[model samples]
Target: MNILQAKNEIKNTVQAYLSKNSFGEYEIESKNQRPLLLIGPPGIGKTQIMEQISKECQIGLVSYTITHHTRQSAVGLPFIQEKEFQGKTYSITEYTMSEIIASVYSKMEETGLKEGILFIDEINCVSETLAPTMLQFLQNKTFGNQKVPAGWIIVAAGNPSEYNKSVRDFDVVTMDRIRYIHVETDYYVWKEYAISKHIHPMILSYLELKPNNFYTVSTSVDGMEFVTARGWEDLSYLLYSYEKMLLEISQDTIYEYLHHEDIAEDVFAYYLVYKKYQDDYGIDDILNGNVSSSIYARLFNADFDERVSVVNLVMDGLLRQVNIYSFEKHCTDLWFGFLKNYRNHMDVSYVDHVKEFIALYHDKLQAELLSDAQKHEYEFVLEQIQKVNVDASLDSKSRFDCSTKPFFKQKENMESIESDLKLQIENAFEFMESAFKNGQEMTIFVTNLIMSAEMALYLSSHTIGIYEKYKQVLLIGSQKARLLDELAH
Candidate 1:
């Protein structure tokens, strides 16, 4: 149901066919070899799975998009040239895609290659002009204008018809030629594989937190998307590298997909779900539950509006998965009792995906009680929730279309009084005293008075006068003369 299982299924099917006999020309291979058509919403890992299969099978992979190549490139005529020098002539042939096809055949003859897989991505986008040429290749294993080499397998991928708005519907003729696989979001399966691969801790956390939201847009279809194994892998790396910033980026990414500004509703819904489950069944009880009659009733209720509640429930369950192992039974029991007593009426079935997820959580209470792996996963989930919060906050902040009152308004009287006081103080000490110039020392008496007043105006106004008077007194004393004698001298 998830990406990994789909990949194994595809590879196993193809490898089986290749083992039986060598498929002929690329066109013939399309006609004879196994051709798989992966159909999924954008971001689901269709093309990547094929690439992986190619590596695992040890076969060469030639990948191209239908949008990138034209009928001219697919089947047009090419140029040939000859050069004559010193009575000897050398000839060289230049062919178009048609001629290239012939060369591949020639090489296949010489090398006896069994076949290489041809991956055509975005096949739904093949232009009108190229369709017939491609049809020719698909039908006869040969270009309209030339022959194709043997030993080639064909695999084409595109967005699913329902989700993709742009792809021209494939006619019965084209549909008949290939086997189809539909990829959907499988959170638990992906989490397991991602963890096994030692994928980035952050990525694991995000998936565990909100499995439905993590996905990529498919390249071919406008508005079409697919979740891929690669995306999860990339997310793991991103979380590991940019731990704190990961949440912000994730929110922006998810925001684009959801196409909505108010994600808090979804987040709140999830929190409620987590609380309900944490209270109803012990974390262990929920994880170990097989198919409970009550659980099934909660999951597939016909009367209630499912869409409004399902996502929140699923998200909460994932959050709980990473955080629960660290919880002590007594604590869990106490919490459950509290929930049952306080909120016995609340529905918690939103987060009951048992066998799929192991226990994990962010709270130290949960981490301390859980296993090492559970704690790590729980922390990652917490990080993801934080990312969602950040994204929501930033997006909401940016929308400042709503009016807000200014904070800390300046009082007119206070402002004017402060301004006047500052000006008066500045004016009182506009000129510096000579004694206070850079490094000049003050008279002991002046220093004592200045230190006491702690007022620049008082000090500045009297500083020079006091210094002058002290100097005159000192001079009169040094010369041993009265004031009148000094003046006469």
Candidate 2:
């Protein structure tokens, strides 16, 4: 399975475990539950998926790299204690709480969450001294003499023996005690994730053209030449920051992240081309519905690569507009809801408290209350409350306009922004239709848009008032269907 499939599987497994057992409840005799062992290549998002699962389940997570621990730290240190056995007192050995176990308890206390996942990475790459303890920990769910807390699930991950020299294969007896999942690299599965994460389009376009270069690990004269999903994501952050600073991306910079020489050179060369496209294509003008005849002529005469770049450029611009509008609507709704609740339930008591404070400090604070800044601050809150209540029954766009009035400073300016976004979406739809009519292949472009729209839909469903505002414009039926077909494949 690919990483995405593995992520879903892990999520389902965690949900099932939580369903069968309530928080802080565990039975030692139960045979239905077992720990998960994720075996995969290095840097293939094994740890990243666990974090995502923790967030999705709304549970706490405690992660540790077992290779970094010793037997003493992992299973705790031994201490001497007095015990009475057979009417004679004797000094016996007992172990303190394992650092790993202590961290789980601390996280639960800090988060106030009884149930969570305790993830140990590099489980198969532990030192020889710690190997026996790891086996006992997995099979018995205990460190030294202390068992894992009841509500926490144990998940361990490791790179396969083929990928890491230190990896040790589990014996049959140990294998029988846990569930295992093997994950492989799939470019298409990760492309959807990259689009949703807003990975640099330069990397996305380069990968689309040379999919084979997306992931590779081979021994070379330079020791090892490799590229992984983790590399791309980390590089994307640096590239984004560099672009913001208007700095020139040097060959050294590219090679620092993309370790493979050939792949790094290819990406750097294509990045130059991508920069050229950005310079030639006026995305802002297109968004404003100001595309000139020269631009259209260029599009008609351009090759497949240029056409793809143009489509990506347009799609990027459109998505940004939609994101901005959706974010504004979400914020406006939240503010309106808060103001309404305060007015209905808390305003009277709040005012009474203020009055009491003034009465108690009339002489000392009367002049302070009369100050211009304090008067303005008090009036501002009341004015905002009034404005929100007045616009509560209006449409989303109208409510947004009212909400942003203080910030935008002009109704016409806000309306103009709203109008511009609508125009951009319409223009994007028309561009996509024209591309299809002209027999231009836009599979990658369409797929990327669909993935972004799906992410937006997910967010909208999770949030209030965003779906009604963005669904029609962002996730139109035709685009949604195309994306579904892609996923089905």
Candidate 3:
């Protein structure tokens, strides 16, 4: 299975476990709950999937690397205590709570979520002294004498023995005590994630051309040569920051992430082409339906790889519009909800809810907890709320009209909006028709655009006239038509 499939499987397993056990209830004498073990190569998103599961399930997560712990930390330190056995008093040994278990309890207190996942990474790479304790933790679901709290699920992950020399293969008895899953790298699966995450377009276009380079691990005289999904994602963030600062991204900068020299050079060369496409075809003008004939001429003259890079650039622009419209629609809905509640439910009080919301915002603000970007969002939401309240002073219908004016304006201009999106789609199709001729490139382009969670959510929620028109544009050609038909089922 790929990372996406493994993510779904783990989510389902967690959901089922929570449901069957009533959110962590189990009898000590009954069958012991088995931990989930994710066995896979390093940097294939095993740890990331666990975090996603935690967020989707709305539960707390406490992650630790067992290799970072010693035997004392893994099972806690021992202390002497007095105990009475019958008539005589005797000294007894007791252990403090394991740091790992203490972290779980601390997260529960902070998040107020009793049920969650305790994720231990590099479980199979523990030190020799801690190996027995690791087995005991997995099989018994306990650290020394302190059992894991009810309602918490245990999940452990480790790189395969081939990936790490320190990795120890689990015995059959230990393996039988867990639900083990194996994950492999798949470009197509990661591509969808990359598109949704808005990974660097340069990386995306490069990977599109050389999908085989997505995951590689080789040993050479210099030591180990490797590239992993984690490496690309981390590098994407750095590139984005560098671009924001208007800094030149040299080949050395790329090689820092992609260790393979040849692969790095290939990607750096493609990145130059990708950046040239961005400049030559202004995405802003393209989005505004002001595309020049010279752009189309250049597209026709370009080779296959260049054409693919152009397609990636255009698709990136279109997705940006989708993201903007999605956010606007969300704000519009929030505005409408506020207006409706304020007018129709005049007798009822929203004081408590409003106070709670304001209190939460102020708490975050005063604690200096919000990042600069998050602080900007917090201010924007407050501004919107204040604007709506100010509009409430007008007459009932006038207030309603004022509050929903932007939404109504957008609704009234659906035709023009649809026309712009349709033009962008047609422009892409025209290039695809002339450049590729066989429609394979067009198929991949449209598939990348439409097969995203964001796109699916937009289509499902915004079934208005403009979205339907945009959908038609996406489903125009035979290749896209077939793809849409398959997705519909």
RMSD (Å) of each candidate, 1 decimal:
34.3, 9.2, 5.0
Question: What would the per-residue lDDT of candidate 3 be over residues 387-447, giving only the tens digit for each residue?
Answer: 4443335555665555556546644454455445556655554555555554456655666
C-alpha lDDT values of all predictions:
0.45, 0.72, 0.74
Cα lDDT tens digits for candidate 1, 226-318: 445565566456544554564433455533434433442353354344445445533333323332456445544422223223322322232
Candidate 3, which segments miss by more than 4 Å at Cα?
A: 20-31, 348-353, 359-379, 387-438, 459-489
State residue 26's C-alpha deviation in candidate 3, in Å: 6.3
lDDT of 2 by residue, 193-276 (tens): 888777888887777667789898899888888899999999999999999999889877998988998889989998998889
Per-model TM-score on C-alpha atoms: 0.42, 0.80, 0.84
Better of 2 and 3 by TM-score: 3
Candidate 2 weakest ten by summed lDDT? 364-373
lDDT (Cα, 0-100) at 119 in candidate 3: 93
